[model samples]
Structures are given as C-alpha cells and as structure tokens.
Target chain A: MIDLVSDPWPLVYVGITLGVTALLAYVAKLLIWGMMRQSNPQITIAAQRLGVSIVWLVGGVVAVQELGVSIDVLLLVIGLLGVATIVALRQPLENFGAKYFADVYTPFKLGDTVRVGEHEGRVIEINAMSTVLLSKGDALVSLPNSAFLRQPVVNLTPQAWKEVVVPITLPGTMDLAAFENTMHRAIARMRVRLDRRYPPIFTVKSRTAQSTDLLLTVMVRRPEDRDPVLAEVNLRLTEAMEKAPASASRAASGASAVDPGH
Target chain B: MHSVDSRWGHDAGTAAEPREEDRDLFSDPEAATLATTAVPAEGRMNAVSVLINTQTPLLQFPRAPRGRHAMWEVESNFSRLVEGEDYRFSPGGVSRMVYPLARRMLTEGVWSDVHWVSLNSHGPEMVRLPGGITLHNVTIQPEHLGGYGKAKEAIWSTVHGLNSPRSSRDLFWTDDYGEYTYYNRVTAELIRELDLAHDFDLFYIHDFQQLPIGQMLGTIKPKLFRWHIPFDSRKIPAQWRPLISTYLNSYDVVVVSSERYRGALRRFGHRGPVRRMYPCIDPAEYKRAGPDDIGAVTTKFGIGPNDTVVLVVARMDPAKAQDRVIGAVARLLPRFPRLRLVLVGNGSFTSASSGLGIPKSRTWRRHLEETAASRGVHDRVVFTGHVSQSELESLYERCAFTVLPSVREGFGLVVVESWLYHKPTVVSVRAGIADLVTDGENGLLFDPDRPRALDRQMLRLLRDSGPLSRKLGEAGHQTARLCTLDAAVRDEVRLSGELGEN
Candidate 1:
C-alpha cells in the first residue's frame, strides 16, 4: 500500500493503469466476440477469456511497477502456479477439455438411446466431467467425458441421421418471434435439400433475464446432405444475425448433428 | 337513472344513450334457459382464468375510409359501437356457437376471466364485449398471408377428400409452410405474453388452422383442442401423420364434433383423451316469424304464394355441393310443378376481404349459378346471399323442407337449425348428424354420391306433405335439444372442472 501522506503521483499512476486495464479487458472481450461470432460459441468464449487475461496481465505488471515492485518475480510466480495447478488437476482438466470437444463432435444427446463401447443405455445427464446414463435394467452409470472420445458410440434412434440441431443464443431484449420468422424464411429457401415431411422447428431449451437458448432442427432429405445442409443453415443464420439490430448480442454455436428426440 | 359501472371505463350518467338494438344485442339469452336447465350454481369453479383461441374473429369490422386511418390500436368497447355500421358479429360457429357458450359460462360463473385471441387483420387490437370476455386480435404481414392461406387451404382440401393426398404430400417442406409457422409463432408469442400476465388455467384452441398452436405454446397449463372439420383418417396424407400426431398429442384432451371423428382421431395415433361434443347453437337466437315476416322475405326473393320452397343453407364452397342440390331440384321440377329452390348464405370468414381474401367463395358461387343455368332452372332457383337472423327465420318458416347436400360435413348444424323450425330435412349420409338420424324417424338420410338418391329422398317429403312431414318434423325438433347451449354448457363446465383437477 502506498502512503497517502507522501507524493501522490505514483498512486495516481497506479490507479490510472488499473482503470485503463479494466476498460481494455472489456474492449478485448467485445472484439473477440465480434471476430468469432460465426464460430463455435465455446471457442469465442475461450478466446475472449484469453484476450482479457493478456490485457490484465500486461496492465497488472505496469501497475505493480508504478508501486516500486519487480515484475519479473510476479510473472515467474504466476507461471509456476498455473503449471502446478494443471499437473495436480490433470484428471479433471482432461475430462473438462474432453467435454468441450465431445460437445462439438458427439452425435448423441440426452434422452437418446446410445451404445458406447460395452455400455448400452439411455443418456440421462451430461455434466462438465461425466455423462450419466440409465440402463435397461434401471441402473445408473456414470462415464467420464474423456472415455467418449476414445470409444465408438452408436445412436439407436430411428431416423437419427436426418437430424441437424443448430444451437442459438439470443439476447433477451431481442424479439424471438421476429428472429424465428426471419430464420424460417431463410431456411425455407433450402427445402430442396431438406426432408419434405419434417419442417424446420425451433425448441426453447432455457431462458434467463439476459439471454435465451434455442435449438433449431431441420431434417435432411438424403443422409449425405446433412453436412452441407448444416453448413448452409449456419451461414444463413449468421447472415440473419448480422442483419438484425445492433442492440442484439449474436452468438450461434457450431451445428450439432444429432437426434432432436422430436 | 343511470348506474355506475367501472367495466366500461366511462361515467354512465354522462355517456351517450345506447341504441335500442344495442340493448337487444346484450340481453342475456342464458337467463331464459337457466330456469329449466340444470346448470351448476355460481362459484362452483375456483374462478380460474381461461384463454380461448380461434382463427375466425368474433366480429368483422368494415374497412377504413379513404384518406382516413382507423384507430385499431386503441381498445374498443362493443357496447358503444353500432352493430352494422361499426362492426358486425361474424356469422358462423364463432358467432352462433362459441360466443353464446362463452357468455353463458360466464353467466353461470364456470369461468371468471376469459381472453379470446383470433386472427383479425383489420379489427382493433383488443375489444371488450359483455360478460367478462375480451377479444385480442393477431395480424400477420400481408406478404406472408398468401403462403399461410395456401398451406391451410391445402390441409382443408385434403381433409375434406377434395384433393388427392399425393398432390400435397410434400406440403410440410414447402416455403409456404414456413409462413404458416410464422403466423402460429406470432400467435403463440402473444398468448405466452398473456399467460405471463394472467396465469391462465387452461387453453382452448379451436379448429385446424390452429392445430399446431398446442405444440407451440410450450406451457404447463392444460390445453384442449376442438376440431370443427370432418376428420377421416384415410383421407389424411401419410406424410402429415407425424406432425399431426405430434400436435394432437400435445393437447391434454382433443374434442371433436362427433363420435365418428373421435374414433378417427384415435385411429390417427393421438395418445390422449378424446371427447365428442356436438356442434351447438342457441335456440333463443331464432324466432318463428309471423305471416308478414315470412311474406316480406318471400316477396324479396320473388317466391309466389303457391310455390313450395326447398331451402339449402350453406356457404358458397365446393364441399357444400350446392350444384348437387341444383341437379336434384331440376329433376324434381317435372314431378312438382310448384317447386322452388332457395340457396342461402354467401361466404365464410376466410373468404372475406378483411380476412384471408381467398376467392374460393366467389368462384364457387359463379360455378353454382352456371350449373343452375345449364339445368334450365335458373328462373326457379333463387340465391339469396347472407340473410339477416330474422330473414333466415322467415325463410325457415316459409320453406316446405331443407336439404344438407354437403359431400362431407363435419356435423351438419343447419340440419339442427331446420329441426328447430320443426321443418323436415333430407340430410346427407356423409354428415356426422346422420348418426343421430334414424331412417324414417327423425329425418331422412340420402347418399350424396348416389345419382338420384337426393331426388328420391326429396320426393318422399314432396309426395306426402301432410302426415309424414309432420311426424318427421315433430320428432326432429326433439333431436335438436341434444345440440343446444344448455347441453353444451354442462359438458364444457365438466371439462373445465376435470382440467382443474388434473
């Protein structure tokens, strides 16, 4: 702590440096969010975290230097702490990292009857570290998320291959009806490649005061058309978001091709 | 001499005097029946708020004048407006059936707060009628309405067996379907907003146009759907089965117009309780006009005193099969020299300029006129489009018999109306009301598809006009009791109570 009775120049400089660091961190988050708006929401969020951390790290060193503290020692201490924490929490960190990748690549979701390796059951819950399933014998089985990446999983749902679920995060202040209408009009143009029997539908997953989570599902006419249809749908959805009012915070995740479970 | 009522948001003492006709419009019809009917006492229910939705609005307003904008954004009170000039009550099941049932239920305290939402593009955003019922209007963009109308009309035609299933099998994937979903989504969002404010206990959705609403609502509250159109499981396209079944299963209970439809719903894979409630009307809404009233309407239609009039009351639509009746009448003209056919009603809400603006009604009417002309009976056939309530009563009083020639009718309520007038009716075998008609007892049934079946049935009434007609008419009047407001109120109250318990 700086003594207030002495010269106040150093203290003012330290306060100014910290305040500017906070402003820069917010700007960095918005910039990263804008740059990766079309990418997976997880990657955008992670990038934002990295950008904020860098800004704070550099500004923190400059602020500490104004207080007559050495910056080298602090950097060395933080680097060692980060390394030790990663080593100690290796299992959980691995599971956590696997959860992110599995979320992007996994074909099965909750309520789906899936067979992973030697286990066959219905998915009941998916957490950060593990996936819970209920067996046919009414037994609950917990499997680490990392194991999903290592095993081959088979989805047993009928016509599950036709499902393409696109997750969207819309600002609460934005009009849901208008957005849905716009997206519907956009998706309708691609009906030639979609299943003629199952129209595109939007299902609300959850909502908060700040944002609403929605899943848009469209069925593909041919099994081979799933990948291209999803990519086109994501592109159209991104264009729709860009055209919307700037007041809305746009965040649409990568398409998750899975059984929507009707 | 004025009373203080806060419901109208006006000082009654200084308010404009309501017209005499307005008083007659607001007169409670249930009070006359409540004395004899077995309605539950007041406060039987827990005063739950209910939400009602339909595609047809309760009232149809006239178009705004040129260079003048209508104040549709403001809330309107029906009591302060004139009937014909300001707004006219829509003429269909909404006006003749749903409105009276809602008013009667409110009178009996079965429902406390009722909010009705409908698709009214030109009407006010909100309107307050008497008896605690509020109407909310939902409008879609003009550009989108065409696609929505096309999709709904296709479903209507498919269900009525007028079109091949293969023709519209891929309707769900068309861009028009997206517009249909847009309309439903907008309505659902508005309903959700209302639900958040009122905490509705139940949602009652009506007819096929709103079939997807139950699935879109995303509410925990119980939903009841009433299908007003003919439902034949075999007529539904295979491609529509999954979506239709999903929508049906979303509702807690599905109510159909007849037991036949209820069975068909079950066959369609609906995993929910189904109720068979007959389409009803208020007997009090009709009156037996005197000689002068009958003579005035007859002269207006150029009916001679010696002519024996046969009436067919249906909107101008192909499914109604007005041409079938015209052909039958042409054949009957040789046997009965004084035979005259009077076709009543013009169009439904869907065909109105203020509504979907579909030209089906106009095209069907022109086709009907051509058919009559080709049969060389244009001089004998009279098309009196959309008669008033009293005029319809006068026509009912003057007619010798009525015919329901629909190719496929959900439930022929016009037969019930004719029965109320104690007039003999020849109903089609395809109608749901045929189940209620015993052969040679209450009414006569004819297969519309059979070439001369309707002509033979009509000859039975024309040959022996005294005793046989009287016997059939008297027994038919008794059958009408099963489909009146009193009977409907009891079933509806029980349904509401059941939903409350669950």
Candidate 2:
C-alpha cells in the first residue's frame, strides 16, 4: 500500500473526492426536488434524501479506497448491518412503506368515522406505522398501515363519497395565498360539474422549511362525477403547481401588479 | 284647550304651531335626506391592530354620473373628495354604530390601525376613514351580487323570524349560494393576505352576510364574530343547522346584541362562549341641539312649531315594518290630527342604486307611501330618505318620541339614541332592546302583529305623552350609560387581550 494513509497526495485526493461527492449530492437533490416538487411532499423528501445518501455511500467507499483501508471487511460489515436492520424492523418497515400509499389513495381522512377489519371509530391520526382511531367508547385502536391495503375500509361520514382529497407539495419559496387563489379560480371553472355548495378548498396539511404539504378538497355533484372531477382537478392542480414558483418569484421582484383573485 | 287629558297627562301639545305646507313633502329635496357634520374624537387606548369585516361598507358609492369621475375611481384619498359629494354614508344603524366605534377605537389608544373589508362594487378599492382606519373594498361582479344578496337576505329573514324559510332549505345547494361562497372566499382571501402583512391582534367580523368569513379566514388567531341580527335557534331551518353551525364554530368567541341572543346561540349549539355585548354608540356623537340643526330641518321639511313630530327611525324595509307605524298613525290621526309621522330613512346598503343593487328598499318605500295614502294619512306622514348623524340627533331632540317599529329588531339601538336625547321611544316587544325597556318606566313595548296594540301605545304616548316621556326619557338616559362605547371599551379591550394572550 506504500503507506497511503501517511502520504499527503492520497489524503488530498480523498478530500477532493469528498468535496465532489457533496457538490454532486447537493446538485442532484436540488434537481430532483425541482423536478418532482408536485409529487406527494413525503415522497419528494424521501426521494431526494435517498439520492443524496446513495451518493454519500459511494463516495465514502471511494474515500476509503483512496486511503487504502480494508475495503472487503468494511463492505462485509455494512452488508451485515443492513441485513440485521431490515430483519429487526421488517414489520415496521412494511407498515411505513404502506403509509405512503395509504396517504395518497385512502378515501377517509382524519376526523372521519371509518371502519377497517373489526374496529370502527373516528380517525384521530395516521402515523408511518399505524393509523389511530378513537372509538365511541373512548378506546384507542392502532391498526397497522399495511392492513389498509389488505382490508376493505368503510367511511361512515355523510356524503363521504362526494369528497376527493388530493395531496400536493410546493416548495417553501412559493406564496401559499397566491397558490390558493390560483387553485380556487381553477376549480371554479368546473363549478357546473361540482357541488355548488362545496367549492374547492385547499388546506395546509403540514409545512417545513424546505417544502409545504397541502390537501385540496372538492365535492362532486354526483358519485359518478368523482373520477372525472378528480382527473380534471389533478391536471389543473399540476399546472398551477408549476406556475406557483414562477408567480412567487415574479411577485418577489414586483413584476406583476395584477391580482385576479382580488 | 286644556293641555292635560285625564287618560295621559302630556301637556306640551302647544309648543309648536302648525304649518300647512308641512302636510305636503313633495317639493323639498332636503327632507329627502338630512344635513351633516363631522367631528373626529381625539383620544388614546391600548395599542392593538384590529381587522373588521362587514358585508356592507360604512360608505357607499353609486356609479358615477356620465360627466363626473370622482366617485368611481379605483382608489380614493377621502380627504381629496367631500363626504356627501364623493360618497354617502350607508343608511342602516349597523354602519352608523360601527363607523363611530372604529373612529373612537382608533382615536383612543385601543387599536393602532383599523382595516375594514366590505363588499363595495362601485366604490374605490381603498378609503381612508378619519384616523387610523382604512376601508378595504371587495367588489364582486354585478352578476354575482344578485345571488349574494338573495342568499344573504334569505339567511337574514330566517334568523330574524320574519318569514317562513321554505326557500332557504335549498339555499346552500343552489347556484346563488355559490356566489355567496365566492364573495366570502374572495373576502377571506383578501383578509388573509392583509393579516399576513399587518399581523393583526384580532379579527372582528360583523353580521350575517360575512358569517362564512371566520371559517374562510382559516387563521388560528383569535376571531370574534358579531351576529347583529336576531338569532332565534327555532327559526333556523333544519338544513341550515349544519352549515350555519360549521361557520359559527369557526370563531373563538361569538358576540350577540342581547342575553336573549346569547341564550339562543347556546341553544343553537355554538361551541365557544356566546357574549352579549350590546351594540352601542358614542353618546357625545349625538348632539341634543346644534344651533342650525333644528332650523335646517324645519325649513327644508316644512315642519311647524305646532305639528307634533312623531318619529319612526328605521330604514325602508318590510322587516322594519314602517308600514305598521303608518297603520298605527292612520288610526291615531282621528284623535291627534296634528300628529305627523316623520319616517326618517330610505334604504339600507342592500337596496337599489347600491352595489348590491337589490330593489327592496325602493319597492318597500312605494308600498309604504301607498299604505299611508290608503289609510288617508298621506299628507300628515313625512318621508325623510336619509339623514346625517347630527341632523338625526337634532331630529331626536325635536321629536316628542321615537318608535322602533321593527317586526324583529336585533337590538333597538335607535331606542338608545332616543334615550340619549331624553326622547321617549316605543319599541316592539320582539326587539332585542325590549329587554332593556321596563314598560312605562323607561320605554313602551308593543307587538307589530297586533296593529291595535301599537295603535293604543302611540295614542297614549301622544295623548298624555309629555310627562310620561319625560319620566321614561330620564330613566332611559340612566340605562344609556350601560350601552355607550365608553362603557363597552373596557370589556372589549379585556376580551381582546384575553384572546391575544392565549
């Protein structure tokens, strides 16, 4: 190995690679986020993080190789640790993965009375591993998120079928009010097909420094109209999400004084 | 003739001599409305920023005339244009009370700045009211205004128990309500943006038209909603319960005009505390007599010294039941032939020639005129379309008594105005202010439905009214202290501070 760990050249090479790795990881994260900002906010975050982690893992291997460390043993140890972690957290990991799908596709929301498997109650919360419900008898039930995929669920709320909630993610730099106004006007164009009483409303589900999570709720005029309204609204939402960043940037620069919503 | 009658010992019947032209109100433009005065209070209170949302603006701007360009500008510096010439103050008691409250709140240290948002399609986008108050106008399309008006009026009538709400069952599901939602949503959107900029400590929403605002605002900050109309839970339709309840629950606190309304709100299942804060005015805002106030009205309206001015202080709406007063006047004309009913309001902001463009006031005014003529008391009835606040105060001073003939009044603050001037007032039993009336002690209460009941009360007030008026007015004046802005300010500040802290 020619004493690579003690050599100045090797140490400098390792430092340069680490710098490149950080730069590459940051650029990749930004590009991925900018491209996938309209996806479910959780999914966007996970995807960007996963990409950066992969870059870090590969760069660490190269750095160790440059330092002439025992690469085979390190790989073996990392592989065993990964296997042990997966084995120990198998059920939780499955539930965690299931939560993402349920969050996107589940018909029932928090505060709705719903039935799944044998238990029924108002949904108090839905975590990564379990969906919690507060029963009428003041009991709490925690159902595995994965069970939502296997078991048939029934929503007991009035006109629950008329509701279609779409989850959207926007970058932190975007103006929420402007986005809301845009979405409102967009949804208003389909008013004839929608229930007149229930105009579309966008509620901020959660927010973070990097991104914001919002849920858009709309009511269909007929149960049969749900699918089409969802598809049409989704398209409009995607378009508005695309324009929001631009609008926000324009507003920041004082480029546009016209506010249609006002 | 002897001044004192055995039945009612009112002795001031000979104070003013009768003028024949007072019988004919056809030619006087000033009688069409009253004259004006402006006096801004100078004081200070706790420093807080407040946002008030009302469906009706304190001032209204009709479409500008063809040759003129002053009123319909996009934005106006009110200082640049005159009050009456540029824009007229809205004619209902809501605006009358709210404008002064904002003024006093701003003049005093209570609020550092006040932003009022209203539906004003014809007015400028922003108006600077005197002091730190700025009026933000939200104008909806004329096409949408009709639907908004219809839906709001439906809610108003149903809550007031004025008519059977057979049509309101479908109100939330109709296209008209869509427009109502649109207006509230737009107003809420604007409010939210303003909140972001101003970071207001409190949001005070008023009346039924903006009920949806609390929910639409979607802010967790403390919200205080005032239901200015009658709130009898039984009168609310079954279908409206869920919808109305949802909107009502959005507020941190619900304030109504009376304890009765507070109880009704509790019965209606309002989640939070229901506060009974009586809508009040600045007692000083009302002048008992300005030197020119009485003469200006007498010359303009053809009023004579001998003619007894029997006043009805309300807008020209069927809900106000000015016709009931007219009917009562017709019956009383036989005994007190010199008794003239001076009906002192034209239309509210909801009426025709307004941004809302509802024609109810014009139609109702014609109906009242027809009612008076048919009752053969046409010439004896005086119609003053609108009046300035000082002129109203002067009229309050000149009149022997005032009548709040509303079929269902939220709170007869006009009764308080009458009391402030030491003028006895006859109020309807259904009025929210009737709770304050002690029946022959402070004010008289009657039922508008029973025309004869109101007829007799008017006769007693007119026949032997002078002594009774003096006593009632004196007692009523004691009660006025309880409802003035001065009295309510401490509680308002306490409530706002409590909400802001927690």
Candidate 3:
C-alpha cells in the first residue's frame, strides 16, 4: 500500500484499455456490416466515425505511458493535435464530405450541365479533388465539391429538371440478370410520374469482385419532386435487392421444368 | 505508219475521247490473255463458309420430347426418331426459300460449311443437319418471351402500315424493348461464340425481326442483311428513322427481294450497298403430282371436280388479308355458283404452344371465320388449317388460278409457287412480287383496298378459256425461272464473293 503509486497497475490498465479498444473496433466493423446489410449510407458513415474515435482513444492511452506522463496530459495533446489537423485541412475535408453527400443527394451527374456560383458547363469528370466542367468554348473549369453545399446550384440542360440519378453499389455475388429484372419490375410500379418514353436506365459504371457501382437514371414529370423521388428510388432498390433472389429461385425452378435449350 | 502511230499516240494524250466498248471489255491484256488462254473452269471444288440467321428456324420439331432427354442429344442424331414422325419442315418463306438456298449451296459445292443461327425456343441447343450444316438455337426466358413477342408485333404492325404512329410511339422505351434488345443480344452473343469456333467467311441475316442483330454484332467480318419485307419509307415513323438507318448501315450490303423494296430502302436513307435478289425456291422440290395425287388432295378436302377452286395459300394472319379474298369470293358466288374459296395454312410458330406462344394467329383466324359467316359464304369457303407439301402441290395443280391478297407482302413467294406449278396468279399490287408482275402478262395485279379490284381479277381469270390461261401460266413459268433456286444460288454466291472482298 505504501508503494501503490510506483506499482505497474496503471500501465496494466492502459494495456487493458488498448486491447478492449482494438477488440471493440473489430466488433464495431462487423456490427456495421450486419446493420447495413441493406446498404444504408448513414449507418456506414456512423460506423466509420465510431471506429476512428476508438482508435484515437486507444492511441492516447498508449502515448501517455511511453512519455512517462499522465493520461490527462496525453488526451490534452491529442485534442490539440486533432484541433490543429482539423483547422489545417478544414476546406478539403469539408469538400470531401460534401462530395460524399452529393453522390447520394445531388440531382445532376457527370455529363450534366449545371450552374454553381458563376460557373455553368457540362460536368466532364467528378474526382475526389473536384468536379471539372467543360465549357462550350472548350475551357475546363474546376469547382470544389464544398461549393455545392454553400451555393445555389441549378442544372441547366434542357429537360434536366426531370432527371434523377441514383448511385447504387451491389455485391459481386449477386446475379446481374436477376437484379436487373427485379429492379425493372420494381421501377415499373412507379410509372405514373416517370416519362414512358424514357424508361429507367440502369447502367453498370464499374465492377469488381467485392462490389459493383451502378447508375440508375429516371425522368420525372415534375422538377420539384426530385428529392422525394430519389428516396423512393433508393428504398425500392434496396427492397429489390432483398426480394430478387427468391424471385430468381422461382424462375430457375420453373425454367428447370422446361428445358432452357442449354 | 510510224508517223501515223506517233500522231495517234500524241492525239490519245491530247484528246479527251470516248473509249470503244470492245476495248474497255478487253482493256487489261493479262485478263484478256487469261480469258482467251484458259478454258474457264465450268466447275471447281469451291468451299464457302457462311453464317446464316433468320427469325424462323429451318427445323422445328413437331413436339417437344416427352421425358428429360435434352434437345441437343435428340437433334444431333435424327436416327433416334422418324423424320415425318418427330419433326416436319417448317413451311412458309423460311423453309421454302431460305432452306433450299442453303441446301443447294451445300449440295452444289457453292458453300462447304454453313452455320445457321435462328430463334428456337423449343429446339435442341445445336443441330447438325445433313450437308455439313449446323443449326444454332437462341433461347430466351418465358417472362421475357412475352415482351419480345409484343415488341416484334409492334415492329411488324408499324412496318406493315397497320398501326398508327401514336400507338407505336412508346415501342422503343418500354420494358418490352429491353427484352427485344435482350433477344437480339442473345442471338448476337451466340453468333459471336460460333464465329469464335468456326470463323465464318460471311454472315447473312434475314428479315426485320433481326434488323438490330447486324448492329449488335459489331464485327469486322462481312455482314449482309436481307430485308425480307416491304420497306416503304412512307410507312415508317419519323421517330424510328434514325434507329432503322443506323441498323441498316451496319451491314456491308443490304439485299431486298424486289426492285421496289430496293428503292424503298434508298428512300429510308440507307446509303449502304443495296441489291435486289428475288426471293426464290427450288423448282425441283415442287413435285409434279399425277392424277392420283390431285384426286387424293381433292378427295381429302371434299371438293368435287366441277367446283371452281380459287386457292389462296397464306398463313392465317390478318395482314394476309384473307377477308378481302373471301369478300371477293362472296361477290362472285352469285355469278358463278360453283366457286369454292380454299384458304390454306394455320398459325405460325409464334402462335404455337411450344414456341413464343403468341395467340394472334388464332384470334385472326377466328375473325376471318366470323367475317365469312357474316358475309354468308361460310359453306362456300374451305378453311384447310395446315396441309402437307403433297397436299399443297395438289391444291396448286387443281386450282384454276391463285390469289395473293395480302395488304402488304414481303414478296409473294406463294405466287411464285403457283407459277412453279404453272398456275395463273392474281397478285396484290401491295406485294413485293408486284415488281415482277406486268398486268395481264405474267400475272394479274389488283389493289387490295379497292372495292372490286380482287373480284374483277377473279372474274377475268375464271371467264378465260383455253389460250388466255395457258398463255398467262406459261409466261408466269418463265418469270418463275428467274426466282428459281438455281438462279438464286448463283446470285447468292456472287454476292457472297463481293461481300467477302471488302
């Protein structure tokens, strides 16, 4: 008891804390995947925030023991470092975050002509750094994604007001044919507002072993209803992904009864 | 002489002059010497590798196998079952015209190996027929089957001038359009896969149903598209021009059945190489039935010798305009009491249960029956659903003359069939065969829409006695020679060589 201050129990506590933090971080990843099985973007973002916070918390404790300092001093130093980092990378980080949100919320996409601030041109490319637009005179103009958050942006292409683009990511194991059929049937249910001449087009942008990126374009009758339509489209896509396998199984079984000419 | 030769040479250099016809013909000394030095080989061991595609398959088994045996296993060897028992030749233009060309090409050594790809839902995956010909079947799901059917029907109706532009406006944007694209894509994929294995020298695609296939294939190989239907630019909608032109331009050459169709294709803005090759059948296949064959067919149909038969051999579809023929017969029944109108053929492969399963043919046939009944000529008209080739040949021989009353025809091959049998035919002016017909010369032409045009033509043929009928039938026979398999094979081979060059 007299030498309690000099005992190694505090270091042991820090080690225990770090171990728990590491374990929690791994568990949180699994939980995030399970909870976001339907691919809810908010759940993914929140899970990522929790994971980073846990990493920093564990690092703080480890730093305190190595410096021969108290946990309190380490936390103060860490907080200052985080504040300095945030301050230094504020604009870029904000733009990056805005781009993430814009991917899900923005009505216009690459190849779409849009007016943001004083710039109006066809979007040639959308990169993590910025969105580049090509003017009629063939001049390239780059705009930071964060500008979309602060300024009033308007899509200028004719009938672009009616366009709503949805970005979707699907697992590689999922059958594309089945998914396409299910998505078509699901989208057909919302045929009232959609222009019949331009039925929803689902284009595969990129694909990999783990996942595939797809763009779904639909033309709406009214310009003001874009937001609500997007939410519905996203919900329908998730529901379709869930319901497609069963329908595909039925089709496969039915096709088996009759020869598929294979 | 030297001064004169020099002056001549100088004059040739200074003068812009017209060349003599014989000189142009023998302009190249090497070619002229080769032509003169060598007796042109009358025949050679020539081998042609061809890829053939049509909406209709060459062979459709009458029934799907009872058990779990695969079609591939069944079709590869026809020895497992009898020919007439297991499968019957699919009748109509495909079996009549296209099959004979392929078969004759193989037999005559014009083509060595033939790969025929077609839409076959209930066929074996692959069939190896006689004469080293292989059949590749393209299959689609039943759910998409309906969509494909609707899309093709829309296209057919639009092209035939049956549907209004407003009704067919959304044809390219629906889910059915996707299925249509899927079917074409599936066919293209099959062709590409076969090309990978066989490396065909030429590709010949037939009919409007497969119009997009040439474009979808996107291959560097020679692609030839045969627009087997009438291609009237006036009938086409403004919205569809771009897409149709785009597809048509994909082919290295476009072949139509008649000069009129060729002109129509040009009007449709197809700047590609276009040729008019008459659709033909093997004249040798039309077996000359003796008295016994005719008696058997007449007995089977329960028609007496005194009955004046006005035969129409067409599929039971509304577009064939059987009702117009019936109306003409109804009007003639009062003048000639012994007239019997015989309508041949039933539903197509599309209407059959084992195929795409569209019921348009049944519905259209029912409507025709109702029209005959309403017109009070039900007993006078015979609805012979489907007949064998022997029965058909007998019917053609027994009839005084035939009438092709289609509102719009691809090319009245049946008229050519009648001509093959040496029977006079009254053809619709709307038919592609109208290009070949001179009124009252080889065959008669009548406007299908005009009130008494068909009746007038029927009366003209029926009232004629010895010389007129004989003269018309003989003239028609001469025209039939131009569209015979022998002529078609030569043209096809020549066209194939030309297409292969570039």
Which residue segments of model 1 deviate by more than 4 Å?
A: A1-105, A116-135, A138-153, A244-262, B1-37, B41-43, B64-71
Q: Write the residue-wise lDDT of candidate 3 on B1-502 in tens digits.
A: 0121121133353356533311221234543453232221232245768889987887776566666366443345544544555555567866457876787677666677788888777776667665566776677778878998888988888888889877787676678876776677667656765765677778889988888788666677889998888788888777567668868888999999889888888777788899999888665455566688789988888888999999999987878999999988889899899999999998787786666779988999999999999999998889899887778888988998999999999888898889877789999999998988999899999998899999998899889885777878889977876776666866776776676567
Candidate 1: count the clashes.
0
All candidates: TM-score: 0.84, 0.72, 0.68
Rank the models by DockQ, top first.
1, 3, 2
Model 2: lDDT to the true structure: 0.75
Chain A TM-score by candidate, in order: 0.73, 0.69, 0.67
Candidate 1's residue-wise lDDT over B1-502, tens digit each? 0111321234453267644322321135554554246367533547667889998888777764333344444456566566666667777655457877887777777778788888887876667776688887777778878988998999899999898999989887776877787778778767766776677888999999998889888777899999989999999999888779878888999999888898898888787999988888876566567788788998899999999999999999999999998999999899888999999998888798878999999999999999999999999999999888778888988999999999998899999889988899999988988889986899999998899999999999999849988988999988987888778887887787777677
Candidate 3 — which pairs collide? none
lDDT at position B137, candidate 3: 68
How far does residue A149 in candidate 2 sit from its true spot (Å)? 3.3
Model 1: chain B TM-score vs. truth?
A: 0.92
lDDT of 2 by residue, A124-181 (tens): 9998899999999999999999999889999999999988888888886676655765
Tens-digit lDDT track for model 1 on A132-239? 989999999999999898889898977888888777777666667667777887887888898767777787767775887777888898999988887677667766
Residue pairs that clash (backbone atoms under 3 angstroms), model 1: none
Can you tell me which runs of candidate 3 are displaced by over 4 Å?
A1-262, B1-48, B66-75
The per-candidate TM-score of the B chain, in the order shown, comes to 0.92, 0.87, 0.89
- Top of the candidates by lDDT: 1
RMSD (CA, Å), each prediction: 7.0, 11.1, 13.1
